[model samples]
Target: MSAPNVTKSNLNFTELPFNVSDSNMSVTESLLYDDEAQEFDNEEKTWMFGAPLLLVFGTISNILIIIVLMRKKFRKSSWGLYLTTLAVCDTLLLYMFSLDSWLQIVFKVWISDETVAGCKVYRFVSYFLVHFVAWILVAVSCERIVFIYFPMKAKIVCRRRTACIVLGSIAFILTGVNAHIFWTFSLTEYDGFYYCDLVDNIAELMGPQFVIIFLWLDLSIASLVPFILMITCNITIIARLIQSDRQRRAATSDGAQKSSTTSIAIMLVSTATMFLILTLPVAICMVLSLNDEFTSTGNNMDNLYFAKRIAEFVQQINSVLNFWLYCLTGKAFRTELKAMLCCGRFSRTPGVSNAYVTRSTSATTQVEHKPKDVKTNGQDNTVKKAQDDTKL
Candidate 1:
């Protein structure tokens, strides 16, 4: 897109919030191209068409996490509540991006009808929710770390209400601060699509010095701070897990206990991986946005468009995979999920195929049989043990 036409005096539309139009303000012709505009239209359609799947899968996975965690027994733990919060955050992500995607898909551009106030609200909510979700994941990882380091303390510290309060505060502050973006963003119509742009009228209002300040502020608050906090927490949690086995070896002598710890580590690692994958691309994009050479080209637009789509896809995959990964690796999650899913099966045949049964049987059989020729024996033992455990 060509830069919006601006009067010489109004060349720097960097105003935050909205600046009242002055005589100096003048419209600049759009920087849009005949060919690139067509490509942008096509990309919008592709994003919109694929968005429903992301929303559907993301919504369903988060809902399942909530349902699975809401059981009477499951609710007794703090992690269950954290999972519920995580699900809610994931759902909100889908909800916000869904609107943006659908708008782009249907209109092939941003809608110009929406006022700057409304656009600001949308941006604020989306940005706040993204940050809130990232911090919540950090909280989850820290909670797990606490569980590993001080089990008793974790029981007291990782309360649901406390998490809610902390997360809510973070969301509120982030949202309020991000509302500043709206002051700078004004709607412009290009090829029938309305886009919120900071480079236009608002930048002119704020002037060049204020614009530079705004850029750095945005980078620090939105990207640097959150990234540092999340990565630090995740790395610390991983470090704790690595040390946990050696630290607790004497205390937790049972095979099941050791295995459970390993699984918990895997679950945390998996969750962290999702956040890393999604955020890393966006972070790189943000850095690239500051490059004069990159932003000056049509290629910058392509790079940004692809990066955002990939990030969305990564986030959707993360939301969907949580249940499966937790179920596959964590005995506790598997047990809880199964009970939530097929309550009747386990209800009538109590303890059948439960974590304890599976873990114990596998351990006993492994000890009894030769390692090289143990496949058949292990299978038989697991089945038989499951049956016996159920009968008891």
Candidate 2:
């Protein structure tokens, strides 16, 4: 039987778990009736089994990232600051959301239900971190574009101090924008289990239509605008990197330079592409699900729920995947990680230096300098001699 339309006063429908259907019976009644069945559906079972494992590993990975980025060699780079901040944000996102989800699914307990103040803190922190992370990515993309297009000016424009200031401003502005959540969320108890939900009083005062409008506005700020910014900046950065590669090839015959540039370009482009791929679905689903018309259709509700759960899963994946992306694609990061893991023993080993020299010599042989033909054999011989000496 189709569930009855439970009173909206008892729970905020939007805050309910995606799998939870709107039924005539209250949330408490539904839970009691389905206690055994609620053990978890296939999707939820997967999340429960896998998410905690990822969370634990992700937490360690982010901590390692933070530690590596804080080192003297990396801390001076503008990208390091953004990456460190991103790691911090990812860590927070996991603890606040992924851990909370595990608890809710396994124990049927909501951390935000502990106290009124806890509700406010949970809602505010969750929303704030979501926006903060998005904007930080936008900042990273913009910084990369500048570093690629204006290498000389980037030293001045993308300083560590500048990154700090930008991050601070982002935190301040986003916190101000999302501060409303602190007051808008409250604990609602049903059948002795408390759920964190939107305050009914505010909903009534604001009206349903107005609330929908506000949600659209929030969605725009939190996802749409940042997504656009990230895509635009990264696209431009990629274009510039390609152009720079061509110019560098024409100007120099250094194979090491080419390899370095290509690796960095791949890293930046891949990171931006991954962000767009993982986040865009969630943004689209959020926008569609927030629309009253879309949710009103009975047949579409199940599809919507599936989409929402998939979106949530992908979003959490995004938070934990950055460390792997960097480690896989970044040569310097791998070196640093190796050193850190070995407690500097790997770095101190003589083989590391010998390997560097071998690679450098090999790289020189791989790329030959193209020279204009000279009428004088002497001049040609002189240039050839110089090239030979430089290679040696």
Candidate 3:
């Protein structure tokens, strides 16, 4: 297929894989840019294959994450607050962004474009949820910073109440930041279908700067700032972990402090690592696309667009990733999930069996009468603990 002689003036931003409202194409460009013969096999396969898998698996997995994080043990921890909110946000994002995009691309049925309010609301919610997903992980990292560096203060500082306050404040500010989309996205009917785009006098409403700043600002928030912050925070976290490990090795006793903080640190690092790996490619693609919009002829438009679409498919996969990521990296998450599935019965040790053993021993020792053979001393307790371990 021959490439179209397209330019930014004639380009339809809405005609990406997700929102191919081709009616937005102008007559001059339409004459050169024949959509009937061109096919995006790779792009189509990407959305087709990714959308369902993400919807089904991602939705279920995020629910499992919510359930696991919401357990009583996590209720008081800031980790629970941040992670649970993230799960909820990811769930909404998968449905709103991934599902809607899939439906529009594959079925040519988009409810959002059917009405003006639907269009604006959909735009607002989808963008808002995306900002939430990225920033919530930042919040998680912040929580870990408190836990690992300020352990003494972590209990007081990283509580559920503080997490809730921080998240709520962020949510409120992000809502205001993205609220412009709700006002700017108006449905314009061309031929028979509606296209979501800025209003006709968008310049008057948002000023000439809207065109200059809107997409770039979005890129900054959704990708740039986050990339820098997560990288810096995680590097600090890695350095701190290295220092702690050195101290632990030099000491004769096991580092109780290290043990307590290690689980959350592992979780934070894994989450941040996967988040960067999955999200950065798309961010790069977006940068390319935005740059190409001004610099390219229609020749490589398809290629640049295809790259972004593929990146988006990966982003969808990220939405459903928490469950698998957690199960792989988090012992407590796996233990809780197993417990939830099996009605308080844990599938392994290091969780339920250890707790059960401790409880049973305590009950025996606290009976109305003490056994003459039992000695209430630290040495005997150590011996008894060893015996219990040997029995297990």
Candidate 4:
């Protein structure tokens, strides 16, 4: 039996054999191939046109975030620490995924699929970083809850060192959890192209039931649990903010709290909301697509593919929006950004001194009026005042 000469030009499979008794097995071989070249080519056009723009803009935004967050003023903030870490993650994601997309579009190859080592490393890092991003949001929300509900404890608990520990722990834990990807995915060559995809031999090694359980467990931990936690934490923070607003308003109409905390709360809430929206579709599609019964039908395959693409694009948009959200919601952030952009000339702008005085006075007033004795914890008070001044 001779093999048919398959090329890039012709993909027609109608002439392929339909009987198992056929001596020429090229048609049988072609029949087994899942031809998605045309679909991928269309997606490549979209990636080529859009990915470069996102890569450039996202890179610039995250760089600015890092610059602003690195300043001594903002660096002391625990929230600022988390944001800085997130900015780093976003920058890495842009570099990694955008380059991968460009290579796929232009070269018709995935570098990660070229070798077993590349496949394992790419899958492991990609999964670990993604979940790390989600968990960081969770951590940020938890910090905000503490700040709003337990202000006194927040002063001691939410330190830069504490944040670093938390972030490092998340990286370590997620890295360990996703280590199985090193074995789950391997190089699969089909139609002269290699893909880093699941090893079906897993079913033979660990049984199909184990594979199904693993998929479900991964989906639950990666998306479902984190999504729920973020939502719950953000909701509680908002509720506390509202309660505090009402009490403060009733006590003194002129006692306007500085917009710093309010602005940060708004930004975090918006971020969490975006995370939920962008990630939910991907989670749902993953669950459905992984089901044996659903995939075996082959009817909803195109719809599932389209849904996953859209969901993934939405998720990528999440990495680019945080910087803009800070600019939009935080007046302090804009001032710092302006200063950085103008080489410190913006600090000499008229009324800047008065704004600084008003902010300092407001912070002082809040600290002095507190029921707790500031003299007992003067150092904590001073740190808190400095943090308040630098708030975004």
Best by lDDT: 4
lDDT of 1 by residue, 198-241 (tens): 64555467776765565555556645766677677678767865
Which digits, one per residue and each the tens of the lDDT, describe model 4 over residues 34-61? 3453454455567777778878889998
- How accurate locally, in lDDT, is each candidate? 0.58, 0.67, 0.68, 0.68
lDDT of 3 by residue, 1-392 (tens): 00111122123344544323467867766644455224355566667777888899988898888877776556556777788888888888888767876886677667666789887887777777877778888888877776667655665676678888999988999998987877777886554555666776778998987865777777787888887888888998889877767766565354453343565577778888898898888788667656745447665666566566667778777778878888887766776777668765444323322222223223222322233455656456545644443332
Q: What would the per-residue lDDT of candidate 2 be over residues 1-392, giving only the tens digit for each residue? A: 00111122133333555455656668776765364234226446766887798699889889988997786447676677888988998899888877876886677566877899997887778778878888888888887676555545665677778888999999998878877767666776565655676776765766666566656766877788878887788778777656756766676776337544345456656776787788787788777777778889754665665556657777788877888898898776776677667665554211212123223323332544355676455667555544443331
The CA-based lDDT of model 3 is what? 0.68
By summed lDDT, which 10 consecutive residues of candidate 3 come out lowest?
1-10
Cα lDDT of candidate 2 equals 0.67
Better of 1 and 4 by TM-score: 4
Superpose all Cα atoms of candidate 4 onto the true structure and report the RMSD in Å to 1 decimal: 8.6
* Per-residue lDDT value at 366 in model 1: 38
lDDT of 2 at 325: 90
Q: Name the better of 2 and 3 by TM-score.
A: 3
Error of 3 at 122 (Å): 0.3
